[model samples]
Target chain A: MITKFRGLVVAGAVALALSQPVMAENVEVDPWEGFNRAMFNFNDGLDTYALKPVTKGYKAVMPDMAEEGVHNFFENLADIGTLINNLLQGKFENAGKDFARVSFNSTFGLAGFIDVASPMGIEKHEEDFGQTFGYWGASSGPYVVLPFFGPTTVRDGIGMYPDTLVDPVYHLDDTGARNALYLTRVIDTRAQLLASEKLISGDKYTFIRDAYLQKREFDIADGDVENYDESNF
Target chain B: MLNIIEGEMLMKKSLIALAVAGALTAPMVAQADATLYGSFRVALMSADDQDLDLRDESTRIGIKGDVDLGLEGTKGLFHWEGQLETTDSDAYDAGTGTFAARLAYLGATGDWGTALAGRQYHPHYLWVNIPTDIFNTATSDAGEWAQLGNNQHKRQDNTLAYLTPVMGGFQAALGLVIAGSGDDADDDVDGYNVAAKYSANGLYLAASYGDVDAIDRETWGVAATYDIDALKLVARYEEQENAGVEDEATEVGAIYNFGEGLSAKLRYSNLELNGNDGDQWAAEVEQKLGKGRVYVGYFDYDSDAEALAAKYVDRLAIGYRVDF
Candidate 1:
């Protein structure tokens, strides 16, 4: 099943990459200047040669409805983690909102293959352990680039350990099945960036670094930014 | 996507029927506003006796509504919740349905504070127990009994409570739980509970006192939590005198967030009841899933009782939880 799917994903990715215009936005921050720039080049090569193509093929092969469902499923799962952070930061009301979303989408939305809650006026929120630390007044420190994983930070890197302990994918004992699911999640996420990738302009590393820090701030603040411009996106 | 199209078609065909139903029900529905809320959970587990056990985790449904009293800065609030018995061994064996009460109360809040009177939870239960109540099925509700007994508030019938507005990161509550009101009963008010709490800078402290008139018992406890980095530490101590026997319990728990939706918990408690002593150790790992929250846990109980003393390793549980 996967072998045939791969062929289509490669074809789709090539087509999509060709269609996207090369635009770069001037980005300034590089905490570990040399290390970060080198890592950025490495990640870009991996994305260009491998990840991007696979995600493109994935999008091409799956029906819009199926694609929507896959996206919704991961998002619903993410909310469970968000709910925990909400409680940790003592945002009880927001936690309640996420509880409602998971309940509605998981049941009525068919295991979160559909987002039944959003139409009901409930906004979806996202959070990570890094943001949780940030909420508790811990600074992001300095931005860093991971080898296989893309953008991250010193604080976020430390935050990764706890999230790893609780990750459901790791709980799955079946290695083949677990690895496959992890790959799917990664591809789905990368596929999403395909569209937004066109929005980059100037130095790609600086653009992503600044965007990452700003986005982290916004998430920590629970989306309470004022006069937010596209740079934060 | 499909549901919307289907709903639109259905609405178009049922426009006339809806017009009639809406006209008849609109007034009654508009008169009162209430939100339907509940957390529905069910789990399949190995039963206490090592049998395959399928059980419900306090699965409940409730409704809460508010009324504007026209008085400035004052409003009336009421809420009621009931448990749904799912896969109850009794129900499965007997084929019957049971609806048990969880919480039902009427309260009003103003500048002064909030006053609630009804079948409510004693303040002691809320202030001291919530920290350890993390699991979907085998939380402190079922597991704490091995060590803490019934000292925490699950709820009480014929009770009243008052909560002070928070000031300077501090709040206080006082409540009473009635055993019964009858001609022969010596003390209709079976228990009185009081609690106070302060929260600041990721640090929280709470203390509660309970007087059980029916049993002539007095219980007092203090609980605290501090968060640093990705770890949170919790400690609790309670001393109670029951039937002229002094019993004390101390619990220490640590929760570490591995990251957003995943975390682990370790809780250890030692209790001395009368001349007998007991201890409980529990560890659990929880993760967020698309459908709900799933958890795996291990519990150990060591007590002076014959049954527990013979075999210390008690139970292992896995469960899922979600509420709407």
Candidate 2:
């Protein structure tokens, strides 16, 4: 069974590699618009009625320094994934920086609560299997709004499995601790994005969709976006 | 004996291989909200006046999923679990030795409520007995004995259940076991159970009542738990009356986490049946590994009745369990 599954994975990767070239121009591909909108509405309702209030309460009780520390700790753990993706994308320098960030922060930063790597001039890079797939010319198919998971492309949705494997919290032995960490990470992420809500203008859905697409493009292109329009936002 | 050992080893290896394969292939099939999970638990137990033996502790594999029905807010859900027999025992010798069905149910849920059909866990087991079922080994747990006394009030076949959506930390479930299905084919309605629970701020309280018509048994139970930091306290009381023979059980337990994947559990239970009394207690320490744990425990049971005394003996157990 293991061998058969590995063969399937290899075949799938090869098929993805040999598929149609990336559709660079068509970023707003929403073939499942109706389904996506419904899911988006469901997610929005959950966020508004449940998650947002809980996150607000979390933020109100947590000190700013503590919140930052928690955020940095999760970021430090995430660097392990960034390092793997960097290596997969053949960006050895960035992979080395990611390794350095994790090592330094985990040790000198007191388990990443302090983020000493940034002070030491180590750069932090955001990389995932989705970006690696895009780097290898895989097309980001139709935009999808997953329930509770929010927005993603088909390619990125598939990427989530590999990312989950690399997640440190996912490997935690204690179920309670792992779940608490997952909840804390979600609240921290939402708290960080609370300030960015002001930047959204026009239709909230459209704005979020366009911004996510643009951001994916920028990340896939390593921030060297071609024909980027500053006035779009 | 060698063949049995070899078979068990092969099964263990195959299970590990299957888990790895599933983990690898999960990404390609990540379309729906589905999970494939399993737990493999075994214990080496030494009982008074008996030889040490390796035993299976309710090892099970299951798949559960929720699918968006595309309705306004409803989703379809299904769960199926089956126990894998690992020990060399005659208790499961009948054609069901290899694997036995534990839970198989289908349901739909929305804002209004949830309804399910098929064989599933009894509310009496979940809400009432679970508070004190903390031991790693299933054999020595007080909850296990309580269920045994009540004709194994765990899962019932041909059950149709409805659950009310939680409101203000309170939820209620009603289940009806239909006759002319599976085991209870001769009766009109086999049984019915109702359970209610309230959980908030580290405190949980649950109550349940069940009636089995074929056996003419009526059972009721209440359970409560409180959690503070690394410590949890649990207690439960249950009573059953069958053919004018009344049985009562009370259990209390505590769990304390020492951090760093180490924890301690202590539990005590007393059961009074047919004017006879039995007492059981256990203490265990567990060390958690990745998705697994290794534990050692001491259990003692004493009873005034000879039948009960012969069944529930003092034992020391060392166990390992892993879930995926």
Candidate 3:
């Protein structure tokens, strides 16, 4: 079953990749707007009815220090992906910094509970397979909303498969421990985002879509926003 | 001419390299098709005046997979499960800390339906008995009722089965016991079973019948479950006839989810064996943590028959279970 499902996913991604034009102008990116909206609504309903209440209860019960520790631990684990992606993108200096951050946080920072590397001026780089693919000249393709996973472009959606394979947490031999860590990470992330809901105004879908697209562009360009033509807006 | 020949040679070398890379990566991708899973369960129980005993409550490991048949909408399936004994007791008749095969089966599925062979679960047990078998313990649950006067109610070896594709919330299965060993040592087809189930809108209903020629027993059961939000209610009724003796059982159960990984389960069963009356009830509270659970349960059994009273006892158990 797993094999068949994955085969379908890979086949679909290849089909989508072939159908899309190479490096088309970044206008009308959301050609599948109808499908995206329906999926977005489905995800929003699930979060509102199920995940939100559970996260609320988790936040109410967990101590602040413990929550922060959990969040930092996952973030520290995420550096492994960032380091590998940086190397893939030919960002050797950033990859070195990422390595140092992981080393310092895992040891002196007590498994990343303390931001010792940040204070030491070691930068944190957010890089993933999606950004790596973008750096290698893969078009972002049409926007899509995945079930449970939320927003992504067609290229980024395919990139997620490789990212999961490289993720340290996904490689944990103990399934119970892995699942516990995953659940904790999700709850911690939701808890962090709870306060940010107030910042969203107007059409929630459009606001999130625009923010996500811009962020992807910024990450792909390595924060050199000046490369984008002013007239493109 | 020399440059073209060198280019062709280089192309051949790169093609060989690509084939080698594909060979190396193919198995890694195929690994996703098969799943390795296990559940480790240990419990501490105190029954009546017995000392505190640590027990392995059905700890097991298994691997299951689906292999694409290279045909449209068809796949081959296989599963092998084994019990892992964790305690110093001969609970499974295999000595302490021994491995015992629980289920081993091979099957095929397609858009048409599914067909399975080898040792597998009884259709009666899957469709009828499971609705009320919510407790996490091996000894205390609705399974006891299904086992009365019929040992083959749970699973049987040398079995062949066919299941129909579900159509509008309904499906059906037929199973035949081709041969068996030990208590069921029949040289030919000794039993046949049929089950049907319907599920929709949080409600499930099922019924099954099994006729075992080796034991001269015929058993039948019906079960139903209705779910409302976080609350689920289940009920089952079973009857067995063997050598002019009749046994009957009725069970009712409920499980309430309190959200945030907490739930409570309660079950009550009434039994009649050869005109002797017995009743049992169990309750448990479980807290789910990741892919594991910690639970505490209490159960009591009372019987009018001396033999039954001697066999069944009151007990309280605490168990921890983790599944992968």
- Point to the candidate with the largest lDDT: 2
Candidate 3's displacement at residue A92, Å, is: 61
- Interface RMSDs of the predictions, in order, are 10.6, 17.2, 19.7
Query: What DockQ does each listed candidate score?
Result: 0.03, 0.01, 0.01
- The ten-residue window of minimal lDDT in model 2 chain A covers A19-28
Q: What is the DockQ ranking, best to worst?
A: 1, 3, 2
The candidate scoring highest on DockQ is 1
| Candidate 3 lDDT over residue span A1-233, tens digit each | 99999999999999888767533433368888789999999999999999899999998898988888888888898899999999998886577567656765765577788766666556688999999999999999999999888999999999999999988989999999999988888888889989988888999988788778888999999878876765787
Looking at model 2, the pairs that clash are none
For residues B1-324, what per-residue lDDT tens digits would candidate 3 score against the true structure? 999999999999999999999999999987759989999998877677678788888899999999988889999999998888877556557463455677899999998999999888888988887666788777633225334423556778889999999999999999998875434553568889999999999999999988877768888888999999988999988898876798888889898775556666778888787888778887776657789876667787764522454646777777779999
The residue pairs in collision within model 3 are none
**Candidates in order: C-alpha RMSD to true structure:** 15.0, 26.6, 22.6
* Predicted complex 3: DockQ: 0.01
Report the Cα lDDT for residue B285, model 2: 63
Docking class for candidate 2: incorrect
Restricting to chain A, the TM-score for each candidate equals 0.82, 0.86, 0.83
Docking class of 3: incorrect
DockQ of 1: 0.03
In order of appearance, the predictions have TM-scores of 0.52, 0.52, 0.52
Q: Across residues B52-114, which tens digit of lDDT does each residue of candidate 2 receive?
A: 788888899999999988899899999989988777667477758555788899999999999
Of the true interface contacts, each candidate retains a share of 0.00, 0.00, 0.00
